[model samples]
Target: MPALRTIPSKAGADPLPSPPREVEPRPATGHLAKAVRRNLTAHGFLIGAVLCFAVFSWYPMIREFLLAFQKTESGRSTWVGFDNFRTVANDPAFWQAWGNTVLYTAFALVLGFAVPFVTALVINEFRHAQGYLRLLVYLPVMLPPVASVLLFKYLYDPGYGLLNELFDLVGLPAQQWLQDPDISLLAVVIASTWMNMGGATLIYLAALQSIPGELYEAAELDGAGLLRKIWHVTVPQTRLVLSLMLLMQVIATMQVFVEPFLLTGGAGPEGSTTTVVYLIYQYAFSFNNYGAAAALGLMLLVLLAGFSAAYVKLSRTEDE
Candidate 1:
């Protein structure tokens, strides 16, 4: 066997270059960059929507609020804080219109709320003729407001109205409908209920259908009669929907305008049918008093906000 050969060393010469420093490949563009781009693109629509709302909705609301505190002359405004509100408060017609509006809201709510719930319950009990009855009940809702108001106007005519004819047939006195200031609000309420109850009835009907059949069966087994079952099970089950409908009715009825405007020819005899919205319209367009109109609008906003807050609190309480 040959002896092991000695290996040579580069003692004087530069050592072989250290292995090239391990160069990590540069990472692709950072995740943060991509994430930022993705977020901007995804939220672009929301940003645009916010811009539009600010430009259109919020700006106008603020402008109206400011206008409410100012005095206007030939479309120019000067600050006069609280004066417009004072003027509105002092106007005799303001109180009158407010009273009429409150009365109309009350009457409309009572008829609108009760009648629809009753109709929904009755319709729900009938397995047959349900479709036909629903169609008939909802038919008025499909009528254009102008058309419905016009039809009711004719029906409420002083001399030749169908209501008068019916009264005569039933051996009752034929009283003036829309012509009488005392009963004109009631007449409008009746027509409004006829037109609006369809939508409410349908909503209530759907809520009623969603109630559990097991609850009804249990009630029956416990010797609950029909009314008892409804009072205990049906009413409780549908209470949320009922409360929501009640709030909706209050909001809508508070804004009543079109029917009374058309039927009574804008405020009816002795301004008996003048609602707050109607008065606002008259101030803004009819009289061109934008400052006063804006003040009234602010007042309405305050009222609606209070109502909305109450509704939210009530709903939260119910949930708790």
Candidate 2:
């Protein structure tokens, strides 16, 4: 029989030291470094857009404001705060131009805003031939503004114009269109509406198409008439889009220039069609008063910005 001997270490002796474990260090990057690199990548992607906005949008706006407060003489610029604004305000054409611009905006709101909406409604109700009708409405927008304005000028002539001829054919007395100061703005509005309404019509069509049929059905179930249904259901549904379009139309009409310029030589008979933008052109190009032009432009900019701000706030509140 063989017996195995048992071995034991001393109780107080230290155990054999273990081997050192392997540890891999991180890439020497911390959370802050990671965030910095991520932000750099994002900013690199946005640099092009930032530069474009700075150069075209913000820079021009700053320059406009600066020009409003400055005057250049003999190739030297002098700071003249409020002087340019006073000159613009004091000019006899200044008030007339503002009045005409306001009047033009009013006419545009009536025709430009309502015509496209009504057109969209009529076209949307047609299941067939919608495309054709829409095409006809949009065709005017394809024409160049210069050509359109010139054609309209000929049509609005007091003598031997197509419109006057049509009036004669219908056994109606011929009337002066652009020649009369009273209705010159109205005539211009009509031409502008014809030229510009296609885009608004298309936008309205898209908004109308987005509405649900169920809303109309519900309104009908409630014994609502056509007008009632439209008022209660359709208008409520499209209010947001309508408000947005109204704002855009206001901005466009306020900036009108080419039509009045080409149609009536920048100012209609008796200075009837002298819109603010047209007046600005006269100040800058015709009169060579850049300071006054900048001042007048700043005034318009402030007015429109205020109007838009108020409209947007009201719309947002209603939505909420």
Q: For each candidate, what is the lDDT?
A: 0.90, 0.90
Q: Least lDDT summed over 10 consecutive residues: which range in candidate 1?
A: 6-15
Model 1 regions more than 4 Å off? 1-52
lDDT (Cα) of model 2: 0.90
What is the lDDT, from 0 to 100, of the residue 5 in candidate 2?
A: 84
- The per-prediction CA RMSD against the true structure, in angstroms, equals 6.8, 5.4
Structural similarity to truth (TM-score) of each candidate: 0.84, 0.86
After best superposition, candidate 1 residue 279: deviation in angstroms?
1.0
lDDT of 1 by residue, 115-232 (tens): 9999999999998999999999999999999889888878877688888889899999988888899999999999999988999999999999999899999998999999999899
